[model samples]
Target: MSMEGFSKVFEMYEAFRELSLSRHSIREFRDTKVPQDMVDKILELAATAPYASGKKNWDIKVIDDTQTIQAIADSIEAYTTALAPKIREDFREGFIEYSQSFIAFKDAPLLLIPTFKVNYSLSLMVEDEAIKAWERDNYVKSIATLSMIIHQGAHALGLGSCYMTGAVIAQEQIKKIIKIKPRHDIAAIIPIGFKKER
Candidate 1:
């Protein structure tokens, strides 16, 4: 390769590294709304993630309604609250407190839920049940990779976002509120917006 080409490659690597290192999981966001075009760009970039068997068996659900966001947050808190009684008395309070952190996206202007649809896997042809189960998990790994790319894309677009799974606890309630298809399950929930001033 020419020296000029190598220099350009190095510059791209340096810029990517800087972007990766600078991103933080932003839990607090300002009230500013994220532009639809910006969100579309992030999703477009995330679509490049490699998936199993070269098939992308996932869909992203973007939520920007304030009432819906609040409803989802309330459902999560309610779900965790229900679990409190099942916990040991000593840890009960701590568990509830920790769960509160899960709803940090309640105020974010946008919420992104990546849903995964389980499809045919060659691993299922194997005789071992354990191996099949383990291989099925690769679907999740692919979605996770896509999600990370979404976060980086958001950061590059001058927005803040957080990757969260705690909201999965309220999947049942959330399903009722959202239009996600029955075949797909929630993989992760990402909240994006402008970062709140510290």
Candidate 2:
């Protein structure tokens, strides 16, 4: 390869390394709107991530509506509130505090829910329930891979995002609000927007 071409490749590698190392989860965001095109771009980049067993097996649900986002937040808050009492008295307060992070996406301009379909192609062939269950869950790993790509793609675009698992605690409520199919399951809730100035 020519020196110029090698230099360009090294520069790209350095940039990717910097992005990977510097990026951190963003819990708060400014009200500035995230354009649909930008959202589409991130997902486009995310689609390039490799899929397991040559099956895409995953999809993303985008929520940009303010009211609907708020409703999702309220549901999480209510569910956690009800769940608080079940915790030991000393731990209840801490649990409530921790639950707040689950709904941090309420303030962001866009929310992405990466979902995976249960694929039984490999699992169904197995007679052992244990192996079957493992194979079933393996399909779900695609969403996590997709989510990380989405995060890096957003970061490359100067946007901030958080990969949230806590929100999945209220997946049933979230599913009703988003009208997701029964076979689909929540992988993670990602909120994206411009970072709020400290």
Candidate 3:
């Protein structure tokens, strides 16, 4: 087809409005299974996400095993349950209540934990100490941008997902289970599954 003809035919795919509008932060999940192939396809789309210097020095730990998921979820709950009381009184009760469901990693069939190496080579290369903060911010932004890609990618594949940062709250304990070294920057724990039909 000609350029104009193609453009007219593909007008609906031009804008990302429908994708954006359809995606939501899903909390509840059905007992439906999300096969490894579908997860791999979504990861493939997520891998195409761009980063600084093409340095894709990020780890995407896919936890599908039920036992490991429960362990990680337990650690998250242990940490959050204790920490929730220290939060501002106005939000504490709600926060604790939410953690019951929020920290339950095993409930979802797929868990994607995205972490970036906490390498400061860029900061160290710069002579000015103040430049370190800029490097740090950029590193975080790089991984965060990739997380957005993964979230949208999952949605596109008819999978519901939640960006669960509770995993980071107990990063120390969860790292032992996930075998990740401490201090590696964990962006968020994403739980993917079919949304429970209401």
Candidate 4:
């Protein structure tokens, strides 16, 4: 191919690669809120992620209410505040920074919880212990994979988002607030919104 043609191809491929790499865990967001239809579109992409054994394993529990999200963020901030000092010195500083992120999440417009259904593991019906263990592990992996796809999809739509497992520290309280079933596994709490440019 000519240099001109090759350059076009290079730019085309680079555009796609750039989109994938540009995604960062957004901590701060703008006041604008995300609509449910937009979120549903992202969820569609997320649900396309591949899983081992073709076993369906997750459910996206999306929360958009400001009051509830604020409460959840408060719980995370308070918990992290109490725990940060007691953690190992190597992790102390990062933990403190992450706690601030939790506090910031209060302003986010959407929160998505990609949960691994615990009942899916039991329903796998594999009698062998080793295979069962592997299946259980992959179920969680599948959920993480789904969350990553959704995060990317959100970015593609000009929105910023962060997948935060640190917020899982408030899982029980969140579960009660969200009314998640007992058999659902909380993988991570994701916050999505318009990011304020630095």
Q: Give me the runs in candidate 3 sitting further than 4 Å from their true place.
A: 1-9, 12-15, 84-95, 98-106, 125-130, 181-183
lDDT of candidate 1 over 42-136, digit per residue (tens): 99999999897566888999999989999999988888989899999999989988998889899999999999877756666768877776666
Candidate 1 ranges beyond 4 A from true positions: 120-127
lDDT score, candidate 3? 0.79
Report the C-alpha displacement of residue 43, candidate 2, in angstroms.
Answer: 1.0
The C-alpha RMSD in Å for every predicted model, in order, reads: 1.5, 1.5, 2.9, 4.2
lDDT of 4 by residue, 1-198 (tens): 999999999998997798898988897888787987889899889879997657676788888889998888777776788887899999899889766755556778888888876434544665677776776788888887888888888998999988888777777767766866568878888889999888
What is the lDDT, from 0 to 100, of the residue 23 in candidate 3? 89
TM of each candidate vs. truth? 0.94, 0.93, 0.83, 0.77
Which lDDT values do the candidates have, in the order given?
0.90, 0.89, 0.79, 0.81
Clashing pairs in 2: none
Better of 3 and 4 by lDDT: 4
Top candidate when judged by TM-score against the true structure = 1
Task: Give the runs in model 2 whose Cα sits over 4 Å from its true position.
Answer: none
Candidate with best lDDT? 1
What's the ranking of the predictions by lDDT, best on top?
Answer: 1, 2, 4, 3
Count of backbone collisions in candidate 4: 0
Candidate 3 — worst ten consecutive residues by lDDT sum?
A: 179-188
